[model samples]
Target: MSVWDDLIGQEPLAHTLREAVAAARDRLSGGSGRGMTSAWLVTGPPGSGRSNAARAFAAALQCRDGGCGQCHDCHTALLGTHPNVTLVATDRLSIGVDSVRELVRSAALMPANGRWQVVVVEDADRLTEDSADALLKSLEEPSPRTVWMLCAPTAEDVLVTVRSRCRLLVLRTPSPPAITRMLVDRDGVPEVVAAFAARASQGHIGRARRLAHDEATRNRRREILRIPTSLIELGACMVAAANLHEVAQEEGQGVAATLDAKEVGDLEAIYGASARDGRARGYPGALSTLKKDQSKRRTRVVRDTIDGALIDLLSFYRDVLALQTGARTALVNDEVRADIDSLARRGSADSTLRRMEAVLKCREAIAANAAPLLALESMMLDLRV
Candidate 1:
C-alpha cells in the first residue's frame, strides 16, 4: 500500500490528479513558458473525495519526485502537517469573514519552506457571501508562489467568478466492486463484511469503511433496512416515521456532541477570564456564534442521517422492483431476499416504483429546508398507502 490507495474507488480521479501534478511539475521545473495557474476547483458529490484529490495534487506539487509517496513532502502533505500548506476545515456551519480575511492576508506572503504556499478550503460551500467575495479577490490576483484549492459538491457551489478563474477537477462515485476490493485488500476487512458495507454505503468510500469497521453502525443500518417490512398498518407507519426521526437524531447527536463540547471549551478558554468581571464586551456575540454553529451542525447531522436512511429505504423498494420485473441482478438488500419476495407478492412493480418516487420527493423536501419530522411523517404516510 501506497498512500494514494486510501482514496478508494476513485481511479479516474486519481488519474486526473496525477496528470495535473505532472503538468504542474513540468511547468514548475522551467520546462514551459506558460506558468502554472495558482488556483483550482475540485468538485464532486458528497463522499466523493474532492478534498482528497486536492490534497494529493498538493502533495505531488511539493514533492521532489512529484508525489513519489516516500518523500518528506508527500508524507507531510498526506498527514496534513506540511509547513507551507494551510487547510481551513470548519466544524461550524460557515467560514466567517474574519477567517477569510486572515487567510487572504496569508496568501500574499512568500512560503516559509521556500516552496509553493498552498491553501485548501475543504467546505467551499460553507463560505459566507462576504467571505466568498474576499476569496474571489485573492483568487483574481494571486501571489506568485500561492496556490488556492477549493473543494465543494459542485462548481456552482462556488461563485462563478471564483470558479471561472481556476482549473476544475470533477469526481465521480466509484463502483461497488472497486469499493469492496479496497475495504478487503487495504483495510483488512473480511470479504463478506466488505461486500455488505460496500452495498450498504452505495459507493461512499468513507461511509463504507465505517460500516465495515463498526458493529454499531452496522446495527443501525440493520434497524433502518428492517423498517420497510414492519410498516404494515397506519399506526405502524406513524411509529416507523417517529422511530426513524429519533434514531437519525440520536446518531447525528452522537457524532456532533463531543466536537461541540470541544469547540465550546476552546471558546471559553479564549474569552473566559475577562468575561468574569463583566468586561468581556464581545462575550454575548461570541456565545451567539457558538450557538449558531451548534445549531447548524445539528441540522447538518440530521440531514446526513436522514439521507442515509432514505437510501436504505430506497433499496428495499428497489429490490422489489427488481423482483417484480424478474431481473436477477444482485439486490442491495441481498440478506433480506425472503422479505423482498414476500413484499413483491403483495405489491405491483408500479407500486414499488411509486414508493421510490415518494422517497425521492421526501429527499428533495428535506434538502429544500422542510422540517425533518414533517417530511419523514409525510413520506411514511405515503409509503403506508
Candidate 2:
C-alpha cells in the first residue's frame, strides 16, 4: 500500500503533499517548481495524523518515484532509517536545547542518498523556548538541500517566529464514519466493535484501534465510565477517586516497566555496574542521573494516563449533557447509551455541564502537579448525583 493509505479521510491534504513531492522531483531534475518549501509546519488536533503526514512527506521526498511506497527509499524513510532523513521525537516532557542543536547540525548536511535531507520533528510544541531559538536560526538560514517538517496540535502551539518561516498544512479530525471504515477496512476489526471504538475515540485513530483490539483498554474505559454512576455519596466519591488513581498508576507502571528495565540495563552496561563488576569508578553520579530521569518519565507517564482517563470521563459527561439538551449529534459513548440516558434523567443539563467542568478542572490540576488523588477526589465529589 502507499504511504498515504493509512492517513484516513485526508485526501485533500494528501493530494497537496503529493503535488509538492512531484514538484520537488521536477526541481531536482533541473525543472522549475513552485509548490515546494524548505520548511513546513503541519498542524492538527491530537490523533489527527500530523506525524503520519510528516513521515509520509519525508518518505515521498526520498522516494525516486515520488513515494511509490514499495521502493527502498520510501520504506527506509517511513521507518526512520533513511540515510538522509532525521526524525526527532521525544517521550520526555520537553525537547531541550541540546537536542535542537543536534537537529540543527543534522539539517546543515546535504542529502546522502536522496534529493532532500529531510528532518521531521514529531513534537514541535514540546520544544523549550531555548530550543525553539536554536531551531529558528536553522529555519532562517536553511540549507538548499534540507527540508524540515514540524508537527504540532496547532499553529498557536508553536512560536510565531517558527510558524512564520514555514508553510502551513492543517489536517481535520476524521469523522466517526471515516474512522469506523478505517478500523474495519484497514485493521480488520469487527463492524460492531469498530463502530463502538470509532464513536468512543472521538476521531483519534490510534485510540479507536486500541479500543477495538485491546480488551484491557476497553475494560479500563468501562471502569472509568462506571465512576460517574458510582459517585452516589461522599464516601463513594472518595472510593471512586482512589480507584481511578490506582487504575492510572497501574496503567502507567505497565507502560513504564519494560522501558525502565531496558534503560536501567543500558545504564548498567555503560557504567560496568553489573552483578559481577559491581560499580565502576564514577558510576554513582551517572546512576543517580539515570534514576532521576527515569523518575521524571514515570511521573509523566502517570499524568498522561490520568489525562486519558479524564478525557474518557469528560466524554461520558458530555454524552449525558447531549442527551439532556436533546442534541442531534451522535453520542461519543453510544455503546453506553442506556447508562447515559439513566444518568441524564438523574441530572439537569446544568449539572451535567458542571460535571464536565469539574473534569476539566481536575485535568488542569493534575497538569499543574497537584496530587492526582486529591484532584480526582474533588472532581468525583463534584460529579456525584
Candidate 3:
C-alpha cells in the first residue's frame, strides 16, 4: 500500500501531489525543482481528508521511493516522527502567535540529511489573527528545502494573505458507494452496516466510520432526527431544545474527557496541590486559567455537536421537500422514509424550505455565541408542524 491508498475517490489530487513529489525529488538529485510548490493550502469539506492528504504529501516528499508505505521513512513521516517532518495539530481552540513563531523558526532550517523540512498544520482555520500574520513571511520566503502544507475546511476560512501565497489543493467528498466500499474493505465493516453509515453521514468519511461502529452515536442521531416528527406543541419544542442541549453537552464532554483529565493532572502536579496538601501559592490562578481554556474548548465542542444535529435536521427536511416536490433523488434519511412521507403529506414544499431556513438561522445564531438552548428553542418552534 502507498501513502495515498486511504485517500478514497481522490485520484486526481493524488496524481497532482505525486507530480510535485517527483519535482522535489528532481531538486534533491541536483536538478531544478520546477513545478514544485513550497507552500500548499489544502481545502476541503469536513472529513474529506485534507490533513490525511497533507500527511501523505509530506511523507511522499521525504520518501526516496515516493511514499512506499512499507519503508521506515514513510511510517515515521506519516506519524510526524520523521526528523524532517513537523505536524502541528493542536487540541486547543486556536493556534497562537507563540506557536506560529516557533513554526516560522523551524521553517528557516535546512533539511536533515539533505531532504525536505516539511511542516503540516492540521487546522489553519483555527489560527488566530496574530498567528496567521506570524505565518505570512515564512510562507512568502520559505527555505529552498522546506515544504509547508496547511489544511482548512475552505479557502475562505483561512486568511486571504496566507492563502494567496500558497498553492491550493481541494478535496471532494467521496460518493456513498465509494465510502461504503472503503468501510467494508478497509475497516472490515458489514456491507449493510457500511451502506447505512455511508448514506447517513452524507459522504462524510470520519462520521461514516463512527456510525458504522458506534451504537451510541447512531442512537443519539436518531433521537435528534425524531424531533421533526415530534414537534407538535409549544411545550414539545422547549423539551426538544433541552434534549438537544443535553445531547450536545454529552458529546462535548465525551471529547473533552481524555485531554481534559490529562491537563488537569499535569497542572495539579505542577502546582504541587493534592488532596493531602493545602493549596499552593500560585495554584489557584493557574488552575483558573486552565479551566477557562477548557471551558472555551468545551463550548466549541458543544456548538459543533449542535451544528451537526442541525445539519441532520436539515437533511430530514430536505427529504420531506423532495417528497413534496416529487423529486427523484434518494432520501438521505432512507430509514425514515415513512416519517418523511408523513411530513410531506402534511406540509408543502414552501413550508419545508422555511423550516430549513430556520434551521440554518439557528446554526448561525449558535455560531455567533448565542445561548444554544435559546437558539434551539427558536428553531424548534419554527420547525413545528
Candidate 4:
C-alpha cells in the first residue's frame, strides 16, 4: 500500500524508524525539546533492503504527516526530487574524496524546504579511507538541522569512529514465507513459482525478485543445481565450471554495461560541451579518469555476479549433503527436489560433504585474492573422484 510497506519483513526496523519519526515530529512541535539525532547507520546483508529503509526514513522525516503517501513531501522524497533530501548512490567501486567533499559541502547548507536536511549514503562500505575521514569530520559537528543516514553491510564496514557516533539499525533477512507472500501479493506470481524462488534465494530479496521475474535466471539456477548429478567425468566437471564462469560474467556484464555507457556518455558530454575552439587541453586527463572508474566498476560488477553464482552453487551442494544425511530440514534447492534426490542416491554423505568443502575453499581463494578462474578450476577438479 504505502512506501513503508514495501520494505518487506523488517518489522523491528520499521518500528524503530517509526519511533524516530515520532521523535522528530514531537521535537518540531515543541520547539526542539529533545532535538533530532544527527546520524543513523543502517546495516544488513546484501539484498536486505538497507538502502530502501533509509529512503523510507527520509520520506518519513520529510512528510508533515510522517510519511503520508499522498503528501507532497513524501512524494518528492520517494521520487528523489525533494529539495532537502540528498541520496548518494553509485555503481562505481568506491566513493572517492571528491564526491564525499561535495556531500560535506551540501551538509553545511540549511534545508531549503525548512524540514530536515537529510543526506542518505547508500553504499557506505565503498567509501575510501579519505572519504570516511571527511565524512567523520562532518559528522563530528553536524548542523543542528541536518540528518545523515548511512547504509552498509555491517558496522565493521565503516570506521569505528564513524560507527560509534551514529544510531545503529540492524535489519534481518526476510523469511521464506514472507518473501513468498510478497511475491504473490505484489508481483502476481504463481504460487509454485513464488515458493520456489523464495526457497532458492535464501532470504535475498533481489535474487528472489530476479528468480520470479526472469525466466533465464531461474533456468540458469536450475541448470547449476543439476551439476552434481551430471558430473560423471573429469571433463564434465571442467565444462561445468567453465559454463558457470561464463554465465556469471555474462550476467554481470549485462548489469553493468548500460550504466557504464551512460556514465561515460555523460562525462564526455560535460567535457565536449566545454571543449570549444580546440582549447580542451585537460580532456585527456578527464578521459583517463573516466576509463579508470569504468574499469573499477566492471571489476565490482563481476565480483557481485560471481558472488551470486557462488551462492547458487553452494546451495546445491548443501542440499545434496542435507539429503544424503537425512537432515529432515528443508533444502535450499527445494524446487529441484528430484535432482537433489538423484544426487543423494548417487553419492555417499561424506563425499557430498567433501564437495561442499571444496566449494567453500573456492570461495575462500577468491576472497584471498586468488584468480577466480584458477581457483574455480582447482575446486572443480577436487570435486572429481
Superposition-based RMSD of candidate 2 using all C-alpha atoms, in angstroms: 1.9
Ranking by TM-score: 2, 3, 4, 1
Total clashing pairs in model 3: 0
Alpha-carbon RMSD to native, per candidate: 2.4, 1.9, 2.1, 2.4
Tell me each candidate's TM-score: 0.90, 0.95, 0.94, 0.91
Better of 1 and 4 by TM-score: 4
Model 4 residue 339 lDDT score: 81
Please list the C-alpha lDDT of all candidates, in the order they appear.
Answer: 0.83, 0.88, 0.91, 0.83
Best by lDDT: 3
**TM-score of decoy 2:** 0.95
Candidate 1 Cα misplacement greater than 4 A, ranges: 33-35, 272-281
The digit string of per-residue lDDT tens for model 3 on 206-253 reads 899999999998998899889999999999999999999998998789
lDDT, residue 6, model 1 = 58
lDDT of 1: 0.83
- After TM-score superposition, the amount by which residue 272's alpha carbon in candidate 4 deviates from its true location, in angstroms, is 3.8
Question: What TM-score would candidate 3 get against the native?
Answer: 0.94
User: Ten consecutive residues with minimal summed lDDT in candidate 2?
Assistant: 270-279
Answer with 2 or 3, whichever has the higher lDDT.
3
Q: Which residue pairs of candidate 1 clash?
A: none
> Residue 77 in model 4: shift from native, Å?
1.9
What is candidate 1's lDDT per residue for 107-174, written digit by digit as tens? 88898776688899999888888888888878988987788999989999887777887788788887
